[model samples]
Target: MRFWMVFAWLSSALLLAVAQETVLTDDALHKPITVWQRLASLAEVLDDIRKQTGVPLRCQDALREMKLAVYVQNRPAREILEQVASLFGLRWRRDDDGSYVLYLPDETRRALERAQRDDRAATERALREMLRIAREWLRLPPEARAEAMAPFAQTREYPANMPYSAYLMEEAAAQRQMTQEQRVKALVADYLSGYSPQGEPSKPKRDAFFSEEDTQGSLLHCLSEAGDAIVNRLLEGHTLGFSTRPTPDALPLPPRVLLPFWMRHAQLSDESVLQFDAASGQFTEVQPLPNPDWGGYWVRLSAWGNSLEYMVVALRVYELDGKTQKFLNKVDYQLHLPHQEYLAETETWRQWEAWATPMEDWTARLKERTPLERPKPTVNNERPLLAADALEWLAWHTGYPVISDASRYVPAWYRDSLDSPRALLTLLSNDLWLRFDPNGYLLARHKRFWTLNQFEIPERIVRPLEAKWLAWQWLSLDDYATLAAAITDEQARGFTRVRRRGSIQFWTAFDNDPLYYELPALRFWASLSAAQRQRALAGEWIPESALTLPQRKLFRAALYREFPPPEQLLRDLPDDYEVGLYVPSVFRSEGVPESRSEALKQSPDAPAFRVLQQNPVSELSVLKYKDELGRRTYTLHEVKTQVSREGVDWKKVFQEAGYEGEPAEAILKTVLDTILQFALPPRMFEQYILNQSRYADFGRHAAP
Candidate 1:
């Protein structure tokens, strides 16, 4: 009220001032300045302007203190002031009393308003998505809603009818304090104006909408006009209000992620995603993003206590697409830590463990009873555990190396839910023939490994619906000899070798891959004498048809190749050095990968890029690609490295981050929430089908 009163008083004074303007005729503002200062403070120059023009300047002390350089050789006082104000990031308006008032620029004042508008638009888009979900929920039977909305809400209850207009009406009555007639007008006005935000597909000036504006009795006209005075956007003539008709009837469903959404504390809604990955610090992706044209989402979260300033999890959401996971959008969210209350974790990176819900109430009774005196793990509250994780937890307690892809290698434990860890271990040893190698690595000859395939480990999750004991077991020569200790070395070696178990082996075998000069091409080059080299360059070896014109020229110019190698290129280097050679696996650049096999996906050794040897860890080698006839060829460079590892000041890191020790799981969840994949319950959605027309819209792969 006080603000309005002050505004009205100023407005009245402006009217009275205008009445006096006719006689006063403030012509000094239009007058030119006399001097040009190279560097002048606003306070000094503006005062000079006031003195010369006899026009008083009204501005804040901060604005007055702003200094700028100007070359204003006899310019109007008003023009000078305008240029000065612009340079200082300020704006000026003529006051009612014929004085100039300096204020902030337009965007600076409306920054918060623009952010709010964006947030509102994102929320509206997500709400439209929910309304569609509600329609689908209504279509589903009562029994199905629970399952369908399990990713979204805790409850199955929802309005039977459309809720958009009802919400608008509620906003009108409760917030707007609109009368019944105005409320009806709002709905009626929406119907007449078609739903297009840009107001494209203009109505054909019909009787139902004779003109663009319903100017005869407009309620929002004054409001929009008032807003226009502040920001020019509200008065846009092209505002196609939303459609009164319902959202589209048919909808494709979202992909079911491999996340464990069923949790004790965290709840993932259909619109809101909360992912958790504590195992691998690196982010993992879940495939098949939603189809296009579905609106994206924006979320605002409340504080999880006084939040710890942490890292931002950048989520790169792509189209649930096989066509290169077409880059769609990105969202970043802070990780939350709610460890005080019984914290929950996202089953996003769940292990395929068997009935492995931690027996939180468990004591060291098993350790007390058994001979294996391994470390006793901290007992936690009992909750559901993924099968793969259960096996790993038991392994952690017993100090066992986790079997690679244990979920696929040992498929039985997923179904066989044992109550105790001993029962699980007992099941493994007695039924699956579990045994460790001399070095403590799990042996590969177990029944579990043989169940899938005898020649190779099957590259798939071989989940048999029913347990089939020794289903694929067969007697191999090794297996047969294992049952008979009397079997001689000759019998064990496929019955070919004589009984020479005590004989000393005279063979020395070594791999030549790391030996730089041992390449076959180099050997061929060395085998050639000078005359042979001359003949070879003259096309004696490698027919002219096989050699391109450029290749022949290169061979002639390069003297057919150097035999026994040239002098050292690194002769300038110091002699005191540590060097050796190690070769890592070379992988094809997947270029976002077409599709990876299950074996390759689960194999740790087959990373897209990895250093097999750690001591000489360096990416200093260059991969040189050569064009050849019907084959890819490369010359590899090898180097060995030895470097001391640097120690990190983790205490300083935690201190700088405002943490006493390790932060809560909520913090991790906050980071994961940024990623939208919510696959849980060990259920996966339909995989993305690679088709001929995958990138039809992207113009990469043309339509089939």
Candidate 2:
């Protein structure tokens, strides 16, 4: 794995070296500048502009003689260009290749006319193709073709430089084009209006619709307005496509009707999500103002304790129309520690484990009880009887070297037998008061040492999940000094908070900073050659701390991958390192419990479990297309099924997102069927006679 990673990095570097040379002029243009300067003619001023702002400016040859003299303070490249255009009675526009060009009034007008002519020509070509396809395939007469095309006949042009697939879709189906046009408008209106298809007002929007708390309405309302402002700015009057719809449905709904939706959805219907009675936290239900047209969501949270610090939150999201009650997914998150009662229960568990017979004692007792000769381990025979022994045992088994801030200690007498490797590790940790991290290390410290620095969050808990596990283990810090001590520089020390992009009321951390802090180090480390990394890890070159924090982290990670701890590498290795060969597997004398039900016992066919066992589909084919803004995305193009009783008879085509991750293949098949149920073309939907003599009509496949 390390070898391949280095190769990939070298390959990428080689590709970058061979790619097109950067244009010096283009780079100079977008660079920002602050300067105090004077300009002469437009040409000279443009030169000055380029020199100061690094913005390449080109003046029309016809306007080369135009003069402009002005003193300017610090201003951006764009602002300088605007001022120049205004002074010379000229205008500037970006070319298709992104270069900026200036033009006089008459020249600009003529350019616009030419663009319009070109647009009309493109539209006429598409229309001709559409008519020809309709005539050949749909058997549409001239009159019928005109009638079918009437809705899109009003000087409608496609987005400039359209992809071939979009052009094909436009020429193939009039209905699809009409539906897409309507869908985009509907999505925009639903996002802005906060109402469902059934004309029900969204709950969150109504509740915070007029909030004065952040001087912005509720969080959802603020978000909606921010999004609207951006869209409005981008939405200039266009000659292509249909004119914008100015209907009542597109307007924002009044507060009175909307407030009730928020009131209704805000109530917690799931007792599991709420009703957690804890001394530190109270349950709060938050209904996200529904975007009825786009989707809607609600969140339930338990915020307990003083200042409502500890929390457990559950979120539910709706897909399609909310009125239909179709939901996409739900997720639960833990953000803080459990209350006192939970901690007390855990203490009780530890005490009970201390009373149970330790595994070493049990094995010793078994040997004494039997007189027969027992098999002995071929490699290391000694068990992990001490703290150092346990560390060596872990190093050999987990394949990563262990680093410790721990001292050697006498073995504990109360280690209980556990079933799995993880369970055994947990027992050792609880019984011995030690910390084992799979990132490749173990720490043994006194009880007080663990309690003193509680704020340090483990890398695992810092993940998308509540980082709650770290909180539970550590007590809350009352002041900044204590908080600072708990956090290592390797851990995230701070977050730069920013208001949610479209909303003024809600706030979110700057995502890129945290991502940068974590990703760059790992990525750079993965890109290095293994030999170089080995040298660094072995201390053959610079000291570990000499490098930056990211580099240190990555270097340690690579070392953990290839080398075991120093103690374990010595000759005449300790017996505990090979203890795995000495350990014996024991089965319960009472025999394994039967958990399967009668139905499963009889046929071994529990429907849900059977679906999981079957690999229904593995690969999903997709088509990549660009939206109006030229952003590319992959959508489902086809779904092929494995052979079953259906004999692999069905093949479906649709444009929608496909499932990923751990969902069962059956669920994916269902989702594909749903999309195709709505997307199949009209002609393709009808039953066809496969064998006329036998009168066998093959209908479309049954709905999943």
**Candidate that would win on TM-score:** 2
Candidate 2 lDDT: 0.29
**Which residue segments of model 1 deviate by more than 4 Å?**
1-30, 34-48, 51-55, 60-75, 78-704
lDDT of 2 by residue, 432-539 (tens): 343332222232332211221222232222222223212222111111112222344433212101111111111111112222122222333343345644543342
With candidate 1 superimposed using the best TM-score fit, by how many Å does residue 375's alpha carbon deviate from the native?
Answer: 82
TM-score of each: 0.17, 0.17
Model 2 Cα shift for residue 110 (angstroms): 20
lDDT of 1 at 502: 12
